[model samples]
Target: MATQNPPVADIETAQISSQTAQAGSTTGSWANGAFQKLKSNLVFRSKWAELNGAMGDLGTFIPIILALTLARDLNLGTTLIFVGIYNFITGAIYGVPMPVQPMKSIAAEALSDTNFGVPEIMAAGILTGGILLVLGVTGLMQLAYRLIPLSVVRGIQLAQGLSFALTAVKYVKQKQNLPKSKALGDRPWFGLDGLVLAIVCLCFIVIVNGAGENLRRGCGAAREGSDQRDEDGDVEGRKSKTARVRKIIFSLPSAFIIFVLGVVLAFIRRPKVVHEIKFGPSSMEVVKISRHQWKRGFIKGTIPQLPLSILNSVIAVVKLSSDLFPGKEFTATSLSVTVGLMNLVGTWFGAMPCCHGAGGLAGQYKFGGRSGACVALLGVAKFVLGLVLGSSLAHILNQFPVGLLGVLLLFAGIELAMAARDMNTLEDAFVTLMVTAISLVGSSAALGFLCGMIIFVILSLRGWTKDKPFSTIWTDRSTPEQP
Candidate 1:
């Protein structure tokens, strides 16, 4: 027996081998599970998903891209690559058609201020990202969400929707005026080429939405049918499925088709003499920050955005995610962290400050994006465009008719506002209306939140508010005195 126990080292070697095998098995099992989950979640069955996902942030993207490239002279390639990478990561992590949008306050201020440049924008982004990262990591984002009333959040969404719709109308009018331009020459409807396309796209959207509702009703009716009518129920269900498939196949690609047509028309009118696009790695510029730049960024850029980020980006987006995709528990912490990380990484590369947006979420969800594949597809497109087109992206996008973009924006805005339809109580309606009014007038979500809070405080003090947590003086009068 002593001889059989040749060496203790041999026993240890066998044990190590066994443990290694177990670990490998466990890792393989996990990998398989993750692969299966991803497969189930990634849906690219329809063309509309890709189109909607790309268009989700066009409202903000168009302006920001132009501002940075045309005005600030930032490297367009680096900006797009940053956006693309972040978008892909967001979609992969969330497994939903979530959005990565430019920070509106930062973008707007950066574009408008002659003094503000890439350095200032980067500083602002870094500052905002640090603030949000701390908030998310420490769990203060959830606290902020709890402190605000739902009605106030709804009001913000409403105000944003109205603003987007108004912007869409302006775009439509601009396209309408294209006919009068001498460059295009005199044509019918003043050469309002994009208007017709916009109308067609709008009609397609309405039809698809209507069909979705009908399919739901048909399924319900079929389920309610008697066992004896099983055959008829099966026939009805099949019809609905066929109709849905047809709608998906035909309507989903309308946006891309229209975009392509616009590009073609653009080339015909003014052809690109250059035969080839230069392909190269994107440029990343170093941000040079000064004390004055830091102060300006903090005051003009980061401070104003703090309220909106809390309300719209975190709270409102979380609510929309739950409403649109039930069973998904989207928390403020996750969203805040995502926004912070996006900006922190993107700004260093001279990308625009980016964050998750409620409007973008609504737009993506409305246009048939059930899973992350929509966003991933868009990310791939953007990444390729950055690599291939780079600076020429402006020319390509410019060729896209503004009127079509308007139609998409209008629908997205409607989807956002429609979310507030559930606020039926009289008090909630009043609060929402007050907040919307203030936001519309001020053109600032932060101002609206403050005004709403003040009004709520006043109403609470007078015992006129619905949410009364404190005991009134009159109620205390009826209580017995303490010993």
Candidate 2:
């Protein structure tokens, strides 16, 4: 037996080979697991879902981009490219359709103030980004979140929704023709085809969303009934699948269809507008800044945006992400980091100021995006368009019906406002409504936040001895468990 045994050297070589093979197998498995996560996060075959998600920010994106480029002389190339790249990165990292939108306060200020130029815009973005980075790294976001009452945050959201709804209504009316006596300028009486089309689109959205909800409820009821019978599992599963498919088909591309229909209608009805478009490479130049410009930008651009950014971009985004994608936790700190990073990097290259908006998230979720694949797809589209169609975008968008765009905004606003309904108690609702009214009337998030804080302090002092302490208002610890 000893003579038959393999030599020691041969035995050692065999052992080494076996070990190598085992190690290779392990490495391969690890690589595969990582690749699978990437695939799941970034890739999907659902074209409709991707398109729908892309449509979510069109309302905000279109108006802001156009206003910046046309009205403020902002560089379209830089804005689109930076935004597209940032969106792609965000999608890959977050695995959700978390949107990157312009800071509305800055945008409004920049658009309104003729003196605010590239330098001011850049300063504002850089300063905001720096502040956000500091907040994120220092964990101040959580501290801030803990300091603010949930009702105050809810009120900001409610006010933003109402404002957007009003804007949508205005857009619809903008397209409508008025009587000769009531007409503003050269407007004709009782005729504007886009308004009719927009009405149809709105009706379609309502019907589809309503039907999808009804179908889901019916399936849920059926499942409840099936729980009594052991063999009904398969039948229930089949029914669920059917309902899901129907819902997806109906609800997923509703906004996109409306948008595309608008474009098509525009082209058919107004080919001249399309013909005027000039397709060419976009011309962009670097932005220059001064100390004085930086100072003004910091005050007007950065300060006004701080409250909204903290509440909507950081706090509301975290809440919405938690609600829509349970177990996929997002934090105020992480959001701040991204927002800061994007602005810091983007401002250097002449990009528009950007942030993660709660409204954009609501809009995306209202569509069929459960995964980042939706935004990833959107990113790809954005990059391609920015590179290939940047110059012609203005003309193309000009042809697109504004009223239809309004319909999209209308729904997104509704979804965002609906999130406020989570505040159940009457006292909370009253505080939120007060904040909403103040925000709407004052047109200021900072003002709304201040008013809410003051109201909360008064309420706390009035009932300081209650079993539910005033401090509970600031802490989410007592929040009723959400399903």
Report the number of the highest-lDDT candidate: 2
Each candidate's TM vs. the true structure? 0.81, 0.80
Q: In candidate 2, which residue pairs clash? A: none
Residue-by-residue lDDT tens digits, candidate 2, 1-483: 366878999999999999999999999999998788777778653566566767877877777777677667777766777888888888888888889899888888887787888789889989999999999999999788778888998999899888888877776666422111122332222333446666777898775554232222221122222233323656654445555455444544677778778778668767787566655546666667888999999998999988889888998788878877786878788999999999998787688999999888877766556567777777777777777777577666655666777788888898889888878987799889999999999999789989999998778776765646665665656577789
Candidate 2: worst-modelled 10 consecutive residues by lDDT: 178-187
For residues 363-471, write the lDDT of model 1, one tens digit per residue.
7766656677777777877788888778666655555566666777777787788778878987678888899999999988988988878876676566653444556
Find the 10 residues in a row with the least total lDDT in model 1. 216-225
Q: In every candidate, how many clashes are there?
A: 1, 0
CA lDDT scores, all candidates in order: 0.71, 0.76
TM-score of 2: 0.80
